[model samples]
Structures are given as structure tokens and as C-alpha cells.
Target: MSEKIIFAGTPDFAAEHLKALIEAKYNIIAVYTQPDRPSGRGHKLTPSPVKSLALEHNIPVFTPVNFKEEADKAQFESLQADLAVVVAYGLILPERILNAPRLGCINVHGSLLPQWRGAAPIQRALLSGQDKTGVTIMQIVKELDAGDMLYKKEIEITTQDTSGTLFERLASCGAQALVEAMPKILAQELVPQKQDSALVTYAQKLSKDESPLNFNHSAKQLSLQVRGLNPWPVATTTFDEVVYKVFLAQELSAEQVALLGKIDDLENGAIVQVSSEGITVKCAEGCLLLQTIQAPGKGRVSAGDFARSKKDLFVRGKCFA
Candidate 1:
């Protein structure tokens, strides 16, 4: 017999796993997602991605603020689900809810265990320039993401990957990983391994303050920052007293670095050169070629195009603070 599952999650990441489970013919008795919140410019109440998917599948949905209320716990207990699958679920499940399922709750976390064990793992991995990251299937505990691992699958972190791209990839990866692990889980053939507490590193949530590009960092670091922040709180820098958002950037080549070295008194964050390829800027360690950028109230365009239209503003020696 197939295991009965109670699904809990909120965002697109969570919805992807639910879709995978549904496609695999898992018995999802009900779904628990965060309450609908005001979204977009109009501030209209919007359902979470998981809720929308659950509704489409005609699965029962619950949006409890928390399980602190005895009624909420009672309602969950009444389901008597054999298992619970959680992915990017916003709310913390109390111990009662965690133990309610016969097989307990398992989480599809977007990072390798013992590292990036908190929220925003995808963005954190990109910002840290990790060569790779992956999904971890683990038994959920009371502590935040401090779970016993059942399975993990790694994927390379390409230089060109932005947080938005990585997010999509990991979401799909997590779905596949969960689907593969579920059979072993149901058959009682999988053993949960304890994570080393010494290797734990938390991924603090992203903040608006981290959006500004700091030229003091190396070009490689700045490039990673720009990529990691894309699609949300995008990296920005002030050039000629105007804030411009950076979308795509790359570290300069050895030839370009030598060319920049020839320029006397080159200061970090100063415009180095502008060509058909892109706009190059000096950095603390090397140089960065800005491929894509967006000025306030303007659509994103190639740095070369921006330079062509605003040549005076991008002249060599102007610094981006």
C-alpha cells in the first residue's frame, strides 16, 4: 500500500515537490501552507504557490498561523497521516506536529546537511562562491533544520549561475531527490545519519542592506554578490550620484587585468574602460566587466548599450561609490 502523506510548504520551491509527489501518484491527504498575504502593487490577497497547486488538485488545504493552538494540533493529529513531506515551509512545526505522522516528518532542504542549514540557502551558496550545493532529505527535529539526513544530491555551481537560476535548479533537484528517497523511506530500508554539529553554518535571511555593491571586495567576490542578489534586492552601486543596479558581471581576464594595471593611480570602483563588449570597472583585487545594468526608472540593458547612450556619464575615472 502507498503511504499517506501530509504535505506542508509555501512558495514555488514547495509547490514543485508537491507536483512531483502528485505525479508519482503519492496519496497526499492534505496540504498546510502559510496564510494568504497581500502581494504586488495592488496589495491584493494572494495564495501561496503551494496552496494554488493543492487547490487545483482538489486536496484539502490548511493555513494555520502556528500549531500553538491545541485545536490546530488536534486537527493535524486527526489526519493520522503515515508521513509528512515539507519543503520550504515557512512556519516552524512544533514537536507535537512533528511526531504526529507515524513515520515522522521529512524535510527537503535546499543545501547539503551541516552547512547552510537555515533559510536562503540557495542565495547563500552563490554569495559564498561554493563550487557546489544540493538538496538534503532529512528527518525534521525541533531545532531549525537540525535534522538527521537520509539522502543528498549535489550539483555544480557554475560561474554564470544567479540566485534565480540556482533557485529553480535546486527546486527541481529537491523534487527529484524526494521522489527517489520516498520508496526507500516507505520500505523501511533507509537509515538516517546524524549530522556533525561542528560543520553547521547558518544562512541568515537576506536583507536590503546587503544590496549595495562594495568595491572594497575582490572582483570575484563582487561578481558573486551581484549574481546572488539578482531577482531580489539586486546589487546596486552609485555612479555619478545615480544608483544603477548590476544584473550580470564577470571577472576580468589576465590580459584585461594587465591592461588595467598600466593605468596610473587606478582607484577601486573607478570606471576603467568602455568598449563594444561591456563597461570595465577597477576593483580592489582585479577588474569587473559589467555585462548588464539598469538605471533607476529604466529597463535593464547591456552595459555597452548604456555606455553608448550615456557616454559622458561613463567616462574613464568616474568612480562608483
Candidate 2:
């Protein structure tokens, strides 16, 4: 309990672990988060979720741009921490900083290691339509996420789980996993297993080019896109040059597919129906119901509301193209 812990992280997911450590009475001596950057309509600087929580606890906080400078590494070394706990910390710690702590560094990674070893694991899992994914506690090496696995906890990935919702679950799961693994790690009771290079899969950072939904894919695949991209570079489709963010969607069932055929001229991306339920669009293999959406420059609204407000734009046979 008296161990000097240094926490490094930047997002809400990381904050959850920091919170658990605080609640569990871990001696967190300092928190290192990314520097505040411009955000929102006003473009005003804002503290990260992890930084905000650390400050509230009166823990010493540091926001260095990077550990490229020797002085920055020295400042970290000055902490004399027994362990460094990292979770979604945007900056990569140099080997010098990683070794500063007496116990070296460990991370609460979002996905099962030897897999999803990069910036966007949660999103990648959903986007790939994986049935399940989990958290990995691993030693932090210089190689990006290529570390010895300390512990792991798996969770099911449901059809309804969006990246945002999955993020919430993973945050809680990662926090619990980290708290449970910490003591074992310090006691040296936990054995570290080297990651299998053969099974490694990289979770590359998402890009804006991946934002637009491609109806040429199957409804199920498109549905995954809708869920995977929610809350960042969100899945979108343009009609009349107006981008509509698809927040919620579902694939058509067999019965629902039977209900089609009323519109023979329909093509992929064609508006199938605009009912109070949602806006149904035809995909290459099936139909997808857009349940929630955000119109251009507007707040999120039910797909029905969007359709009702623009009846002609959503009429049957009108293509998303």
C-alpha cells in the first residue's frame, strides 16, 4: 500500500483505472497525462479525463509533450516510483522513462495481447465483428505493446455493443483487471508470458477516410461500421452533400427481408422505407435500419424524426448517392 505509483494515461478509460487505484488505496504519487489541447465549439483548451481526476485527488500532475528531452526523463526519474501504471497514455515513454520506476512499467491494454496491440483496439474489435474481446495486463517494453502478458480477462462482444458502449465496459473491465493484477505483480507471484509474434495483429489508428459507410458491403458489415465508428470519425453517408452521422443501426431479419420486394427498382444505398421505427436502407446483401442519426449541423435525433422532417429526401427509391 505504501508503494510509490506513477500513473500515466489520458482518456476516460484510463481515468477509470486511476479511480479504482485511488479507491483501492494505492499510493499514486504522480499522474502523467497529455498536455491540454483545443477542443469543442470554442476551441478552448481542456484537461483530459485522467488529468482532471488526478488533480481532484490532489495528486501531483505532469503534462509533458514527450519524453524526448533528457530533463523530461529526469523529472520522471525524480518520482522514484516503485511502479508505473499506464493505460491509453497518448505519448510513448522512452526506454529511459520506462526503466525509471523500481518495478518498471505495466499497462492495462484494451484487447487480448498478441492481438489488438495498438491505438484503437476496442474500435477495431467491433469493426471486425469479433464475437469477444478482453483486457490484457502486460509489462511495458520499448516495442509498441509487444510486452510480456501479466494477466487477462475476457468479455463477450454483443451485437448491440457500439465502440462507445464497449469502451464503457472495457474501462470498467480494465480497471478491475489492473487492480486485481497489481498486488500479484509487486509480490512477483504473477508469471509473465511472452507474446506470440505469430498471433500478433495490429490495431491501426482510425482515419477520416473510413468515416463514410459503404453500402456495397453486407448489411451486417455495415451495421458493424455503424457501431464501430460511433463517437469518433463516425460512420456517415451523404445525401445532397449533407453528411448524416449514423449513431444506431441494425441488420434486417429474415422476416423483414420477406417484407421487402415492394420496391423492385431499389439498389444498394437506396432508401427502403421511412417509418416511425427508423429509416431502412438497402444494402448489397440485406437491409439496415438506421435507428439514430445526426443531421448536418444538428444534434442527435431519432432516425424517424430525421425522416419526418425531410420526407421527400427519404422517399423510397431515393439513393444515398
Candidate 3:
């Protein structure tokens, strides 16, 4: 109950775990998060979710630029922590800092280990159309997410789950897994299992280039892409040199697919009507019904509003090009 714990995290997902540890009566001595960075349209500096939560709980917060630095490692060792709990901390740990804690470091990873073992795991999983994904608590190692598994909890990836939606669910489940495993970990009853190198896969961080809508892909793939990239670097299409963000979409049915006679005829990114849904022109595939969209310099609005604003732009057979 009184094991001095050092918590390292940066995002809301990590903050949730920190909250759980505190609530579960663990001794969280200090919290470490990434440094504040410029955000929003105004580019004002914003504190990370973990840092904000730590401040609220009156926990000492540390934002070392790099843990590999000697000074940072020294400062971390000074904590004299029995265990270091890390969740999406966004910083790599060196051997020195890893050994500083008496019980070693443990991480709450967002995906099943040996798969999706890097940043943007939740998004990558959804974008890849995986049927399910889950959390894994592991002992941190120098290798990237190559740590040994301590405990894991699985969750289904539904057809409608987005990165934002899945993130909140896993955050809660991950927090519970971490809290439940802490005692077992401290008592040395939980043994860490080495991940299989053969099955190792990386969930590379999302990039702006991945945001643009590619019509050449299938309707289902496009739908998954839209969900995975929602709310950031949103799946977008260019129409009249203006970018239209696709926030929500769905795959076309066979009947609707039949209506899209020739892809080239439909205006690329142009609005289309199929089976009572508003779809967008894609190069080689059936229309993708866009449920929500945001135009450049404007707030998010329904696809209907966007369609109405450019009524002529959305007629059937008009190609986006």
C-alpha cells in the first residue's frame, strides 16, 4: 500500500492511469510528463494532460526533455522510487534510469505486445481494421515496447470504434489493469514474459501525409481510415483547392456501389447521394457517405450542410477532378 511509486505519462490515457493509482491507495511520490508545447490555432503553450492532473493532485511534476541526459537521470534517481510506472510517457528510458527504481520500471502499453508496439497503437489498430485490440502492462526495457508482459486485458474493436472512442475505453481498462497488477508486481509474484520477436510489429506514428483521402482504395478501407484519423490530421480531400475534412463516413452497399457507374465521371471529392446517404467521389471505388465534415477555416458541420453550400458541386456523375 505504501510503495513509493514514480508515475511517468503525458496524455489523457496516461493521466487516467495515474488517477487510478492514486485512487487505489498507492503511494505515487512524483509524476513525470513531457514538456508543454505550443498547441491550438493561436499556438499558445499547453500543458499535457498528465501534467495538468499531477498539478491538480499536488504531485511534484517533472518534465525532463530527455531521460538519457545524465542530469535528468540523476534527478530521477534522486526520487529513490521503488517502482516507476510509465504510460505513453513519450520519452525513452536509459538503462541508468531503468535501474534507479528498486523494483524496476513498468509500462502500461495501449496494445497487445508483439503487435502495434509503438506510438499511435490505438489509431493504427483501428485503421488496419483489426477486430480487437487491448492493453498490456509490461516491465519497461530499453528496446521500443519490447518489454516483458506482466499483465494484459483484451477489448473488442467494433466496426464503429474510432481512435478517440477506443482511446477512452482502453484508458479506463488499462488503468484498472495497472492498479490491479501493482501489488502483485511489487510483491514479485508477477513474472514478466518476453515478447516474441517474430511477431513484432510497429504502430508508426500518424503523419499528415496519411490524412488525405485516397479514393483508389476500397470503400471499407476508406471508412476505416476516416475513423482512425478523426479529430487530427483528419482524412481530407481537395475540392477547388480547399481541403474538406471527413470526420465520419461509412462503406457503400452493393446497391449503392452499382450506382457509381464510372469513377472518373464522378467529381473527385464531390458529393453524391446513394441509399439516403451523402457520399464523396473517390477515384476507383464506390462512393463513401460522409456523415460529418469540416471545411478549411470553418468549424465541423454535417455533410448535408456542406452539400447544400455547394449543391452543384455534389450532383451525381460529377467527378471531384
Score every model by TM-score.
0.97, 0.95, 0.90
lDDT of 1 by residue, 108-140 (tens): 999998899887899999999999999999999
Candidate 2's clash total is 0
Model 1 error, position 43 (Å): 1.6
Alpha-carbon deviation at 155 in model 2, angstroms: 1.3
Candidate 2, residue 195: CA error in Å? 0.9
Q: What 10-residue stretch in candidate 1 is worst by lDDT?
A: 259-268
Q: Can you rank all candidates by TM-score, best first? A: 1, 2, 3
lDDT of 2 by residue, 13-69 (tens): 999999999999999999999999899999999999999999999999999999898
RMSD of each: 1.2, 1.6, 2.6
- How does model 3 score by TM-score? 0.90
**Cα deviation in Å at residue 14, candidate 3?**
0.9
Give the CA lDDT, 0 to 100, for residue 298 in model 2. 86
Clashing pairs in 2: none
